[model samples]
Target: MGLLDGILGQVAGNPEIANLAERIGLSPEQVTAAIAALGAAHTQPGDTVAGAADSTGLSPDVLQQILTHLGGEGALGRLGALLGGAEGADGSGGLGSMLGGLFGKA
Candidate 1:
């Protein structure tokens, strides 16, 4: 795990959430609510911001900006995995598959 491994592990009450809210010009409550909705909807963590944009009426551009600010290249790197393109270290699918295993997708 990397530095963000510990950080990303803490979603609720994470100060970054509030920072993201401020950066996106939204209330922290709104950000959390959107995150919750997306989580329940089975949206990939990497895509949560984009999916939340649709549900919360936030612009995709702003959401992307928020993600970039929060994760930098690490976040960008996850996209391929989230989209089921990048292979995991074990060479058994990618992050999408890993998340599917967690959520019982298939």
Candidate 2:
């Protein structure tokens, strides 16, 4: 699917994400902008979640909400826990999954 389509899908599937944006006072266009910004990024292989937040137009808090809703409470949490379950890996972190620095200087 195209980028825009994928984004709409993300928001549609997750009401929390939609509510978070609404509560944050983000306009539909701003939400679109945020998602588009994220989509255009290409995070490095070792980049931390914070680092990706900096590159995207959206803030870390906003990003967290998006991520939380993207995979739903159950899936991403389980995914995060499963990934964090590895020995020596620090717990209490986000999903190890990377979506690339989609908003690469665009």
Candidate 3:
């Protein structure tokens, strides 16, 4: 569950994330499980997402695709969840290309 590990690593280190379980109103164990889910979740452009999948050992291409579709708000959370969230406010992955196709900055 490398993806999950990365997400957890990020969450654990979050200055704003006091207690994920507490904030989410989930038990510590449940929080762990959720983190695990994030790890297992997969994204598209298989090549780009493969390295993360290999590390996280997750298996949910569909979810990843959905997350990609969701863009900044959704995909971003997932990306931050995976990339430790220190990468700024920008969400993970390229939503522009995935959204309306490559057409330069709107």
Candidate 4:
């Protein structure tokens, strides 16, 4: 799995895809595919969950639930950090502002 996929897997509150899948009523493979789609969508220019739903054929609500389970904006911050916009020494930088805009948290 790639970094984003690994982070998604971890952020869903479990590293075991099967466990999260079972809870969400999807197979592990489905969950994995959805996670991958979510990661891809995150890099695109719009609503991440909605975009993932469009590509993955899952509903936005389901994707949002998964996102919420994965720590929501907090997870986005971590993802941004991993992507290299490390909030800087003063904790103000690309990641924070960019993620804030992404989630309307600004």
- Using lDDT as the measure, the top candidate is 4
In order of appearance, the predictions have TM-scores of 0.39, 0.38, 0.29, 0.57
lDDT tens digits by residue: candidate 2, 1-106? 3534544454434444456568777765555445444433322344333554776656777765555444433343333333334324563222222121111111
TM-score of 1: 0.39
lDDT of 4 by residue, 1-106 (tens): 4644544544345335566678788876777677667766877899898889999998888778667755674565555555564556775554345434434465
Ranked by TM-score, the better of candidates 2 and 3 is 2
- So what's the TM-score on candidate 2? 0.38
The residue pairs that clash in candidate 2, if any, are 40-102, 40-103, 41-101, 41-102, 41-103, 42-100, 42-101, 42-102, 43-100, 43-101
Model 3: lDDT equals 0.40
RMSD of every candidate to native, in Å, equals: 10.7, 11.9, 10.5, 7.2
Which residue segments of model 4 deviate by more than 4 Å?
1-15, 80-106
Candidate 1 clashes between residue pairs 3 or more apart in a chain or in different chains: none
Tally clashes: model 1: 0
The TM-score that candidate 3 achieves is: 0.29
Report the C-alpha displacement of residue 74, candidate 3, in angstroms. Answer: 2.7
Candidate 1: regions farther than 4 A off: 1-12, 34-51, 72-106
lDDT of 2: 0.44
Which candidate's TM-score is highest?
4
